[model samples]
Target: MHCQPDYKHEVYIWLKSNQMCLLCDEATHSAATLCNTCEIDLPWLTDGCEVCALPLPISGLVCGQCQRSPPAFRQVVAPWTYGFPLDSLISRFKHQGRWPLGQMLASLLRQCLQDRFDNAELARPDRLLPVPMAAKRLRQRGYNQAAMLARWLSRDLDLPLDEHLLLRPHDTVAQQQLDAKQRQRNLLKAFALAPGAQVQGQHLALVDDVLTTGATAHSMARLLMQAGARQVDVYCLARTPKPGT
Candidate 1:
């Protein structure tokens, strides 16, 4: 059996009840100030590439890289660009054992989805799939941050969360250090649909904590397509803006 974090649900409930900020862990002043930390230090992504959500020139819809070679996922949605307080929060949630932050991240993601789908004509997914981590990495982390966020998102969106639909078969090298081409190469064959997991004719949304090179999400998207998923949307908390843009 996979090792599940003990306080995942508990922390989520606490955040819902306490009215604390997701970013700062203090009392929230208003709907605008959902959390204390978000008020003063909220890292916002004002200008981002439409295709991958990477920070870009405010006027362009797609980044040069994305235009040259599009990714497999249909669209990417992220509340903030990876930077400052957002980066610190992600680090805490993933590495420092702060599971409550997952709830906060999910809350933001939920809001972003509402905003995106409200005035747009996009179809919502039938199910949510968290990008699976390798078994070895899952053991070391004790929990998959993507899974945690997906659980909360599933509840918020009234969609089913499919935890076993995809598996990360190989532990690929980190994408942070790799260029776009190298990143894609490293993630090839890193993911596969689990045996007997049927996604035929289903619209699936892939959730993750961050979108860096888009390599992992693209790999997962390819696997889902092979499993007969009708469509795949990528959702994440943060998008690391391409450097210098």
Candidate 2:
């Protein structure tokens, strides 16, 4: 079931009280409008493999790379291909210090969830977990984009958002520079459950802004299942389609 935005008058009041710029504030602008600079300069994933969400030929459902070796996550859904205006929007939300875009992006992600659940034989997760960031990154960024998205999604989906259930234990090299195997290895042991965390018999949905290599989501999902989650689903605002397609 999908809920329309209420656009509470308090939303604007809260924005003003927080001294946040609805369009330019560091937290949510990516949710409102993309800045001119980032709108033109950001890198985008134009074409990608369907299974892994890596750029690929548009003709096949699963690319050769995924056929040879599959990822751990069961399925993935993204609203837009990671390209152009969308890429710029993400870059600003991620790198340019705009955090509010997280909310806007979450709105988009909510729509994707509604569509997928409406059209497919998918199970709705009981909980939503954001792909966590390392302590250092969290401090530097002042917020986790995934967590921000998860918070809003929780409101939209009426599911509890468990922010502390999972955490990134160690910082790893950027996955963008790694190959499939290297990407998996780099993220290995990078995430772990928080002390005394419990997810027994629950369904979990992992949220992230972008699905690049599926390495990070795979690692996180494994941990969630180890903690007793019965099922896991992956959600992102954009998927980097394989290179050619």
Candidate 3:
């Protein structure tokens, strides 16, 4: 005869699937790593430029910068503006080597991408390219934050990840320490495509944790297009708003 489920086993299963908020001890009512309250309160972007996803006064309007000179990447899909607790969490994950926070943030980004897809705000692409880390930085940090996020997205989205296809030939000074003009100059000729790789007529999605000055993503996209990728889109977790916006 079939037997009834064990009461203690049922409780264990429920507890395992129901996760507490990462920010607090309260139950999140589901398997989500973050609670609804925290997720909603995060710095979500509203009005923005389509090309670079820069914050603008109105939606569907191109920013002055993009109008004058468009970036190589076609569009940017970023859900949150970089600030507050999200910034602090990313800082810890990136600087302190806290892997759990990185994982949690990746999961949240997957959810955000799903929401955008559902609402027709974004489109799916053929491949995901995690931004390459310089060898020195990789050796020091023990991980690439972009690659870590790409790993999670690869599974969640069931998309192919070209994590190793892009290579950084030269290590430039930190982009954070430079102004936008300096960032652009520093990133010139910084990325190279591996020989024998084929991306002709393919839609590539560049994955990164954040977009600061847009120089790095633009540089990578230019290289991809020059190498014959049909289209390039950016999928980043966060974007810093324009100063004085």
Candidate 4:
């Protein structure tokens, strides 16, 4: 599910400026590595279900699935659909340890959140929580991509990052290729709240690389709400479209 990145492509993200675009190799006259043209061409999610961020034909409409059974999270805020160079970049950052790419994406995501905040379209969460990865997978990958993103977002957004507030003690069968129902079943008991976590009445955001089926986010949000959290929202790099849509 991951790859080894070419060493030549790696860069010390913060220490570098006037960077080359990761996708096009154009000189980006900014601290961010992505060039403006490539950023414009990325798969921006202009319209989606307000609650789930499931790709929809219009911007503010709730999908039938959310209407039938509302998810625990209040909203899913993602800036892009899972497609194209964005997907490839995420794969490299997530699976191949290309952290500079991850940082670039997180910076863009921060911009999205900031715009929403300025327009009163989103409420700032009390805490940012990365989706807890299973220990086995964490060991194999040498990092949790979600946590890395959360760290960067926390720094940029001046939000609290709780890396240990949630725990994923064990691994499950891969959720890829599984339908929504099966994915939910696979994630049952996949997460736990850490001892003494003070989640009560706290608005929290779950950070992850991508939102696919919404199964994982739903499960985790339900867990937090059951434990007395006030609200939950999802913050991720991209959202996959509904199947066949």
Which is the leading candidate under lDDT? 4
- Candidate 1 C-alpha lDDT tens digits along 1-245: 85876885667466556465655557765443254445446677777887788887674578887888887788788878888877988899888878776676778779779776786845789899999989998898788888889988988878789998889889988787899889989988888888888989999899999998888888888778877888898989999877674
Question: What residue runs in model 2 are displaced by over 4 Å at the alpha carbon?
Answer: 1-60, 119-121
- Per-residue lDDT of model 3, residues 70-113, tens digit only: 99999998878898879988888788766666777877789888
* Model 2 per-residue lDDT tens digits across residues 82-155: 87767777888777655545555676568657776788746678888888888876776666777767878889
**What range of 10 consecutive residues in model 4 has the weakest lDDT sum?**
1-10
Best of the two (1, 3) by lDDT:
3
Residue pairs in collision within model 1: 21-35, 24-37
Better of 3 and 4 by lDDT: 4
C-alpha TM-score for every candidate: 0.88, 0.75, 0.89, 0.93
Off by over 4 Å in 3: 1-19
Stretches of candidate 4 off by over 4 Å are: 1-15
Question: Residue 61 deviation, candidate 1, in Å?
Answer: 1.1
When 1 and 3 are scored with TM-score, the better candidate is 3
The count of residue-pair clashes in candidate 3 stands at 0
Output the number of the TM-score-best candidate.
4
Lowest-lDDT window of 10 residues in candidate 3? Answer: 1-10
